[model samples]
Target: MSGEPEVHEEFEARLKTYEGRPAAETGVGRDPVNEPMIRHWCEAMGDTNPAYTGPDAIAPPTMLQAWTMAGLTGRPERAAAYDELLRLLDESGHHAVVATDCEQEYLRPLRPGDAITFDSVIESVSERKTTKLGTGYFVTTRTDVRAGGELAGTHRFRILKYAPARRPRPAPARRPGQPGERRPRPVVNRDNAGFWEGVTRHELLIQRCTDCHTLRFPWLPGCNSCGSAQWDTVAASGEGTVCSYVVMHYPPFPAFDPPYAVGLIELAEGVRIVSNVVGVPYDKVRIGMPVRLEFRRYDEELVLPVFRRYDEELVLPVFEGVPE
Candidate 1:
């Protein structure tokens, strides 16, 4: 998803305040995922294990990844805000951003009934040298997933926000049914160009780390899990549910006006990605909503993979039962 320059500037300003504040400690809150959520995730991933759906449910290992990133539960709390300098750094327009890389370490298993809290901090921020177009910064946020005040897991998210090639236009008036600008696009390069190329084809491709046999998205030369350098490209089914989402209004991208919805979509193959929900109103794009892949052309070599809603009104499981 993208944001306008002004709103981008404002966000950067606020982030600066968060820089030295120390990752805001989150209080114990109710489990964001309830029974329905659990069922949806299990079904979305085609995971029918009794443990996840049974009365005594043990959460899936990846469930904590979703739970912690949902941000603080209940009302908006300042406990997680970043410093001012960081905020200013975020002002540059960016879209359809992905976590090009991430590292998560699980210390304990999470059961369905466990009440967990994620105490997250802005781990670090580093600037990238300017290439042909514009420049950007990489921000890493580390969150400690805690269950009943005990350590359960730790997540390190590396996100890149870059300046847009074209300047954004003025944001339009709010409309009830539309989506605004999207988030920043993950930085693409020669090594991972094939992955982005797949997006242009409306296909999801993962690089299987040849040495470790791990499926890697957003393309990486070395395995984030095992540090293996060999990798092979494989096609994936571009289908999954909304793991989480955000409705951006403050900063609108020129390509998209206010307000649009950007989501953390977990693909059927188990790779979680960031994109927008199309062919449906933003208000209706709820968590757990099923979506299918669609290709978007951004210039010549660049194609973006976005999602469109699938429901009774629109058939879901679009890629399911289809031949591989």
Candidate 2:
């Protein structure tokens, strides 16, 4: 009764069957929501809100996923249906995987000593679609967390499993001895245009919520605390320490060289920004190493902010790339 078998139609039908299947059942948290973990998270994120501290402290709403993590040992209660679905995709040639995004909704505050548990389901599977990364189905999983048998929050995580598309970028046309292609410009919009504008004037600006006065970087339109949209700018002290860092060694882009250190700099003003850590060997870069701000010109047209250690001589030609 079937004509020539449809290629993707049959595969998609099989995927749809797995939707609503159990992903995890009654997954218990390894530890109760407590103060130490909250303190560590706040330190790493440079969050100084007093609401997260003191005897009356409550866990940050963003820590919803932390209490549910299974850690290095892996989750024991994970259902097989999710694994089987992923295996089905792997066998069908969509092998590479990337987490596209996630969202969380908090219903109530989590207090210390509160026991936590969660259950997850394969929420949805999208029909086949092509993207710049490649062609694949988007799989979404929804996890509901409970404290003392009461719903506390929900987390929705989405990922793309696909066979990567082959992309061949040709060399840019140039006269002899000219520099390589100029660096990828950071995407500037209404929310972040002010930050970039400060860079032009050799100043680093951090956003402060007018209501709660909590400082934040990478400039969001509204404060995560109190949801206040009113904000003001505070110029940074230019003194910072390398809170964390990673060295990029593979998958070189056109405007960047491999084996350079990128760091999360914690400024004296209690906010963090990401920038290239130059003037030192990549391996020599270490956490807690002090860094200071400096603006470097890559060419006549582009200039960017970078941090350098006090000991190393200034280096030229550091670059940052915008991912496709």
Clash count list over all predictions: 35, 0
Model 2's lDDT to the true fold? 0.84
Candidate 1 off by > 4 Å: 1-21, 27-33, 69-75, 78-86, 92-97, 129-134, 166-324
Error of 1 at 140 (Å): 0.7
Residue 189 CA error for candidate 2 (Å)?
66
Determine the C-alpha RMSD for candidate 2 after optimal superposition of all C-alphas.
26.8
Q: All candidates' lDDT scores?
A: 0.65, 0.84
Write model 2 residue lDDT over 160-255, tens digit each, in one string: 987665433545674322565567768999999999899899999899999999998889999998899999999998999999998875445666
> Which candidate has the highest TM-score of all?
2
Q: Residue 207 CA error for candidate 1 (Å)?
A: 66
lDDT per residue as tens, model 1, 1-324: 244678646655544445545454674444544677678788899998887766777777777667754354443322535534344555444332335457888898776557777677776665342433345666777778888778988888877665543334444773322343233456878887788777666668888888778887667678998997878877877678898988765444444554567889988877788887666666567999988888865443445788877676655543321111
lDDT score of residue 316 within candidate 1: 50
